[model samples]
Structure formats: C-alpha cells, structure tokens
Target: MKIIRKSDPVNLRRTVDQGTVEQRKIVQSIIQDVKENGDQAVLSYTERFDGVKLVDYKVTSEEFEEAYDSLDGEYVQILKEAADNIRAFHEKQSTKSWFDTQSNGTILGQKITPIDAAGVYVPGGTAAYPSSVFMNIIPAQVAGVERIVMVTPPGKDGKVPAGVLLSAHILGVEDVYKVGGAQAVAALAYGTESIQAVDKITGPGNVFVALAKREVFGDVDIDMIAGPSEIAVLADDTAEAAEVAGDLLSQAEHDARSSSVLVTTSSSLAEQVQSEVEKQLADLPREEIARKSVEDYGMIILCETWDEAVDTINEIAPEHLEIITEDPFQELGKIKHAGAIFLGPYSSEPVGDYFAGPNHVLPTNGTARFSSPLNVDDFVKKSSVISYSAQAMKENADKIARFARLEGLEAHARAVEIRKERWKS
Candidate 1:
C-alpha cells in the first residue's frame, strides 16, 4: 500500500474489462445463434464453454434434494436466516400504485408494475456464491415478480454448486438452470425451448457475461454494467489500525483490479495501517491476489483535515465505504457518494455481503456518484397515469396546445385541441 500525502491525488480507477473486439464478435454470434436455434444453440455453447453435455439443462427435484443433503444443516439454517433478513429489507422497497384526485376531477397517478420475469445469472468461479443468489432474487420476489429464472455454469460433472442450489431452494426459486456464460445471457434475453425469455436480467459475471449483458441490454433490461469490486475506508485517529487493515484486505482479495483505499486525518494511523496491511497480506489464503491488489491499486492517504478526507472520498465515489471515526454518523452525512456506507468498526464490509440485509450488488468504478444499489425498484417499473376531467381540460387546454406547438409538434397540438373541441360539442 502506498501512502499519499495531503498534496498528492489518489487514483483508484481500474480499466474495467469491456471485452475485446474478438470477444464482442463472439458474443454477437452466440446471441444470434441462440435467437435462431433456441435450445440447440444454448446446449452447444454450454458444452463448449462449461464442458458438460446436458440432456436437459433445468435442475430437477432430485437435484434440489441432493443440494439440501450435501450441505450441513447448520449452514443451511444460516442461509435461511440471511434470506429472511434480505427479504424483509427488500419488502420495505415495494411500492403501491398511487393516484391523486383533483378538485376538478383530474386523476394523476403512477402505476407500479413488476416485470413479468427476471433472469439471475450466478457466476461459477473458484467457489459458488450463494450470496449472489440471495441478493438478486429476493428483491424481484419482494417486488411481486411472478417468475425468477436462475442460470449458472455447470461443473464438468454436469451439476450446479450445492451452495447455490441450497440458497435458491431456501428462497423457493425452483427455476434453476445448468448453463452459464454469454450463452446463458442470450437464453435469458431470447427464449429457448427449456428457458423462457425474461423482461430483465440481474447479477454479476465474467467479462464475457458482462459483454453478453451489454449486447442484450435493449432487448431486455439489465441491472448494470458492473466493474470490479472496490472499497474505501474513511477513518480517523480513534480507529484501530489492525481492524482497518483487515477490512481493506477483505476487498483486496476479491480481484487484482479491486481497489482498497484508506483516507484518514491521522498520520500515525496511516503509517500503522500501511504496515499492518503488508503484515496481514502474508497470512491471507488468497495472498497472491490480495498482494497484487494492494501493491497496485491500494492506498493510504494522509489528510490534513476531516473536510479533506470527506472531499477525497466523495471524489473517489467508492463502491463500499466505512467510516471509523469517533463520529461516524456525522461523517456519514458529510459524505455523499458511496454505493453502501458502513459506519464504525462493527459494520464490516462482508457483513453486508453475506448475513446483512442490504443488496451486495452495488455500483463500482466510481459509478456510485450517479447510480444506486440494486433494490426492489429494479424489478418493477412505473407508468404515469393521467385522467383529465372536462373542467380541468377546459381550464388548461390553450396552455397545453401552445406548449405542444412551441415544440413544432403540430399533431400533438391538434390532438389536444381535438379533445377540447369534442368536449365543447
């Protein structure tokens, strides 16, 4: 970790993998083939990419039972509690259709409607991420989306990870599929024989999957073009160096491109954390990956004042932020740009990633400045409702006509005028 003085600037941005021209070409070809051949293309690509030949891609009841039996009863209980917490948190985000009736009988409102279906793609990496399953599905369920389809790459043995299956079973997501990569995204966007097309797709994946999501975005709504993981800790002298170092390493171990930064006002704390990070990295299981991240993208900045620390954090617009100052709440209000804010030492980043209720799918690559964390709102859309009474239209018809005509939209102006004339008759 590098120590940046007050005068120096810290750059935490990673070159997000947008996929090469060759990769993009492959993704396009895959999407086109899936669109034309449906399930045949999906199976072909699944075998090519996932190294499995599946007679049927859907997970059966027998497989779900295996998933349950494979995992310990204690770990399953933990997953259940986590799922409940996630569902309860997202339930608060559900919205109802609302209408406002005016004295003149005009009814103006917004109708909230959930998308008919959503596709959640869980990545098959070094390990299975059941956390991704809970984060993506619970919000769609809470929003009243009737259908939630889950897709993931099958192992060479032709089976999805038990942890992922267990999480889905806990959430009651019965439509799990054994497919992944760009092909899975294509199947979601355009229906196959076994899979139905989804209105929206959500979840994180590799560069190829990200490319597929980018390609199919307009055809079906996507969550976001997510980048690598990132975290920025804002701490002061009161913060413990060891705890701060551990929190920083937790994100660093995610990916080499992952950014871990500490912006603090205390020079002594900064020096101590920098040393502690290097010492702790030696013992991390993912030492090589964490070391690369800390060496390249990590930073320990020394700020002269609290205002400077806050301003720098806002500029970075980190994906996850932790405030470990004596007054974390006061600092929280001052800070304005973070995907998820954790206050004090107890609120560690992984707490939200696993057991905590908040969605872990957050904006990255400084995207938190404008975007937000995934919620029930992502699964549902709003339609504006307008009911103009005769009295209300009569009162404002001329103004509406003039405004429409100002845009050189003669048809729009005439449309309003024709309605008024019909009422006049």
Candidate 2:
C-alpha cells in the first residue's frame, strides 16, 4: 500500500481520477449506435459480448415464475429479509405533497410526486449481487414510482442468473429484459420495440455502462456515474486492526480500481492494520484483486492528531467512511462529507451494502464531496404549489409590481398591474 504523510491534498485527486478521455469516446460511439439501431444493435452487442444470441429481449413472466420456484428457499428468504429492511429504511424518507393556506388566503407549499417510470440496470458480469437489486428497487417502490423496469445481461446459456431472477421476483419487478451494456442504457433512454423508455435509470455497472448513462443523462435521468467501491476507516489506538483490515479489504475486493485508505493518528494502529490487511488478504478469495487494489490505490496516512485525520478525510471525501475509534459517535460531528458514514466498529460498509436500511449505491471518485447515496428522494420530485385568492393577489400585487419595475421587467410589472386594477375594486 502507498503511504503518504499528511501534507498533500492535490495528490488525492490525482490518484482517483484514472479513466481516460478515449474510454469515454468509445462508450459514446456505442451509445449512439444503439440509439439509432435499437433492438438490432442491442442484440448484436449482446451476442458479441456475452456470447449468447437473444431472440427475445424481455424476460417473460413464466421465466420469473420458473426461476422463483427453482431458487433455494434459503437464498430466497435472504432476499425477502433484505428487501424488507430496504423498504423500511426508504419508507421513512417517503414524503407527501403538502400545502398550507392562511385566512388571508394564499396556498403555497411543495408537492412531492414520484416519477412515471424508473429503470434499474443490474450488472450481470463477474457475479450476481441480489443485494444491489433490493437497494435500487425498494427506494423507487417506496417513492411510489409507477413502474420499475430492470435490465441485466444474460449468461452464455441465454438466461439471466438465478439470483438475478429470484431478486426480480422478490421485488415484484414484472418488466425485466435480458439486454445489457451501453445498448441497454440506450434502449432504456429511447424505447425499443420491446423495452420501454424510462424516466430515470439507477444502479452500478462496469465502465461502459457508466459512460453510457452519462451519455443518456439528458434523455433520461440517472442515479450517478459510480466509479468504484471505496472505504475510509478512521482509527486510533483503541480500534481493532483486524476489523479495520477486513473492512478495507471488503472494498478492495470489489474491483482493481476500488480504493481503500486508512487515516489514523496512532502510528502503532496504522502499522498493525497494514499487517492485518496483508494477513487477511492472504485468505481472501479475491486476493489478487485486493492485492492489486492495495498496491495501486490503498493508503495508510499517519496523521499527527485525530483532528488532522478528520481534515484529511474531508478532503478525500470517501464513498464509505468507518469510524472505528473509542468513541465513534463523538467523532461523527467532525465528518462533513461522505456518501455514507458507518458509525462504530460494528457498522461496517457491508452492513449498509447488504442488510442495513440505507441504499448501498453511493458516490465514488471523490464525488462524496457533492453527491449522495441513492434514496427515495432520487425517485421523487417536488413541484412548487402556489395558489392565490383574489384578495391575496390584490394585497401582494403592489409589492410584486414594484419589485418587477425595479428589475426593469416591464411585462412582469404589467401582468401584476393588470390583475391589480380588477382585484382592487
């Protein structure tokens, strides 16, 4: 792992922004082709990449039913439990459109409305993550989205993964398609003969998928361009190095681009955690991936004090921040920017990713400084509700007219003046 002293801020930015302009251009070309050709392009890309010829794009209801029946009871039950937790967590974030009216009579408030349709793109390469299904779908469900359309790439056998099917079944996702990659994104943005267009698309995927989403953003909204999994553990002498190491490795195993950094004030704890990461990584199934991640992007920055460590963390703006100190709750106030803050040693990144109510989909590549985790809010939009009685309009008309005239908006002033003369009498 790379070790740097606490003096550099620009170094962090340089380390994280690794993707090139050429990659983005290549993805852009693919997106445009799919947009133009529709299902033909989607099918061709699917056959080329996945090595499966798809006759049908959408997964039929019978397929979901058969998959649900075929799945093991144990795994199915886990999906249900996780979905329940996700639903509950996002339920709290659900809001209703409300209006307030005074006797003088102006009704002004905000109306929260769910989007018409939401698209969820679940990654099918590498492995099937049922957890991601729950995280992406439940929030839109909670927000009362009319329909949730899911897209996943099929395997060599021309079928989606059993876990992916089971997850779709558990969430009651009726519309699922076997299409994936930039073509799937294009299909979702501009409806094909089979797959319907969606208002917003959400989930994590490979670089091509992210780049496609970026291209289709104006045509359809997207959750975020997720870079890679990242975790920052803030530790001191009191924290357990093994737990810290495990947490760091958990993120590292996600992808080679994944970053895992440990910012600590205690030199002894930093040394212990580094040793522990090496020891634990040896036993990991994804050891090579984690090793490369640690070798390339990982860091153990020795801070002079806890306050300095916190400042460093804010600058890093990690996607996942774990407070593994003696009093983690006390340190919570110091953390200003992070996608999700895992408080205490027990609250690890996996907890939020799998079981915890919060959505695991988070901002990465230092975007935690601005972006946030996916939630019910992303599925819903607020519209300003304004109503004025004749008396109310008359009372406020002079003020409106005066302000408009001050801004040299003659038409704006005239509109209020036209209403004023009639309402005044």
Candidate 3:
C-alpha cells in the first residue's frame, strides 16, 4: 500500500482523475446507441456482453411467480425481514407539503410530490447483493413512487440471479428487465418498446454503470455516481486491531479498486492492525481482490495527534469513516465530510450495510463533501407554491416590475405591469 505522511496532495488528485475520461467516452457511446436503436440495440448488447440471447427483454409474470416458488423458505424470510428494516428506516424520511397563511391572504408553502417512476440498476458481477435491492427500493416506496423498475444483466444461462428476483418480489417491484450496463441506463432514460422510461434511476454498478449514470444525468435523475466501496478507520491505542482490520477487509473484499485506510496516532496500534490485515487476508476467500485493493489503495498513517488524524480524514472525505477511539463521540463533531460515520468498536460497516436501518448507498470519490447519502428525499421533489391575493399583487406589482426591468426583461416587466392593472379592481 502507498503510505504517505500527509504531504502528497498532487498525487491524490491525479489518482482520482485516472481512467475517468476513458470511462466516460465508453459509457457515452453505449447511451447513444441505446437511445438511437432502442430494444434492438439493447438485445444486441445483452447478447454480446452477458451472452444471454433474449427474445423478450422484460421479465414475464410467469417468471416472477416461478422465481417466488423456487426460492428457499429461509432465504425468503430473510429478505422480508430486511425489507421491513429498510422500510422502517426510510419511512422516517417521508415528508409532506406544508402551508402557512398570513393576515395579508398570501398563501406560501412547499408541495412535496413523489416521482412518477424510478429505475434501479443492480450489478451482476462477482456476487448478488440482495441488501442492495432493499436499499434501492425502500426509499422510492417510502416516497410513494408509483412504479419501480429494476434492471440487471442476466447470467450466461439467460436468467437473473435467484436472489435478485427474491429481493424484487419481496420489495413489491413489478417491472423487472434483464438488461444491464449503460445500455440498461439508456433503456430507462429513453423508453424502449417493452421498457418504460423512468423519472429517476438509483442503485450501484461498476465503472460502466457509474459513467453511464453520469452521462445521462440531465435526461433522468440519478441517485449518485457510486464509485467503488471504501472504508476508513480512525482508531487510537485503546482500539482493538482485529476489529479495525475486520472493518477494513469488509470493504476491501468488494473489488480491486476498493480502498481501506487506517488513520491513527498510535504507532503500536498501526503495526498491530497491519499484521492483523495480513493475517485476516490470508484466510479470506476474496483475498486476491482484497490484497490488490489493500496494496494499491490501502494505507496506515501514524499521526502525532488525534487532531491531526481527524484533519487528515476531513481532507480525504472517505465514504465510510469508522472511529474506534477511546471516546468516539468527542470526535464525531470534528468529522465534517463522510458518507456514513461508524462510531466506537462495535459499530461495524456491515451492520449499516445489512440491518442497522441506515441507507448503505453512499457518495464516493470525495463527493461526500457536497453530496449526501441516498434517502427518501432522492425520490421526492419539492415545488414552491406561491399564491398572492389581488390586493397583495397590487401592493408588490411595482417592485416586481422594477426588478424585472432592471434585468432588461421587458416582457417579464410587462407581464407584472399588466397583472397589476388587471388586479387593481
């Protein structure tokens, strides 16, 4: 791993910018082809990339029923339980429009409306994460999105993973399409013959999917350009090395691009955690990927003070920040930028990923500085409501007209001027 002592800002930005341009171009082409050709283009790409020849792009009702029948009872129960957790958590974020009435009869408020439809893209790579299904759907459901459409690439045998189907069924997602990558995003952004265009798209995917979402953002609303998974541990001498290593490896096993960093002021604890990572990586199943991730992106920095360590963490703005110090609460207010903050030793990353009731879909690539974790707010939009009485309009008309005329917008000024005379009554 590249361990620098907090003086390599130049190399850091360069590393983040790597491969983004090429990725964007590739994703752009895929989106254009899908937008131009529609279902025919989708079928061609599906067959070429996923090796699944499909006469029908959408999953049939019979197939959904069969998927339900095929799943084990125990696993189905688990999916239901996870859905309940996600639903409960997101329900707290549901917001409603509110209005305030004043003596002057001016009605001012905000109206919160759920999106018409939502598209969720799930990855079909190394493994099927059913938790992602719950994470993506629960927010839209809480926001009262009318339709939830899911897209995932089929396996070589021309079928979606059983777990994916089970999760969708449990979440009550009716529309499921066997398409993936930028092509799937294109299908969602611009409707095909079978698939309906959606108001927004959410969920996490590989670099192609991330780049595709980035390209088609204006065409359709997206959750975020989710990059690789990451976890940063802020530990002190009182922390246990095994817990820190375990939390780091939890994200490291995600992909080779995944990063697991440790920022601490304890030298002996740093060495112990390093040894623990090596020991844990040896017995781990995804060691090859985790090792590459740890080697390329992982770091163990020893700082002179906890304040220095927290400052460095703020600069890095990692996706997941785990503080396993003597007093995690004392440092919580110091953390300004992080997708999710896990405090103390027991608060592990997987807890939030699975049953902790917090949305696991978070901002990556230092986007947490401005972006936010996915929530019900992502699926709902607010429209400002302005209603002025005749008298009120007459009172404010000249001010509005003058402001508009100041900007050289004669038509806008005239619109207010005309309304002023008409409402004078």
Instruction: Identify the leading candidate in terms of TM-score.
Output: 1
What local lDDT does model 2 show for residue 351? 92
**Candidate 2 residue-wise lDDT, 70-141, digit = tens:** 888887888889889889888998788999998988899999999999999999887787888888998998
TM-score of each: 0.96, 0.95, 0.94
Cα lDDT of model 1 by residue, 1-425, tens digit: 98988687545555457888999999999999999998899899888887788889999999999999999989999999999999989988888999999999999999999999999999886668999999999999999999999999999899999999999998889999999988999999999989999999999988889999999999999999888789999999999999999999999998887899999989899999999999999888999999999998899988888898899899889999999988798887888889999998899999999988999999988888889999999999999999999899889988999999999999988888888767756
lDDT of each: 0.91, 0.87, 0.86
Better of 1 and 2 by lDDT: 1
Model 2 compared with the native: what TM-score? 0.95
- For each of the candidates, give the backbone clash count: 0, 0, 0
State residue 418's C-alpha deviation in candidate 1, in Å: 2.6
lDDT, candidate 1, equals 0.91
Comparing 1 and 2 by TM-score, which wins?
A: 1
For this target, which candidate reaches the highest lDDT against the unseen true structure?
Answer: 1
Candidate 3 runs further than 4 Å off = 1-4, 7-25, 422-425
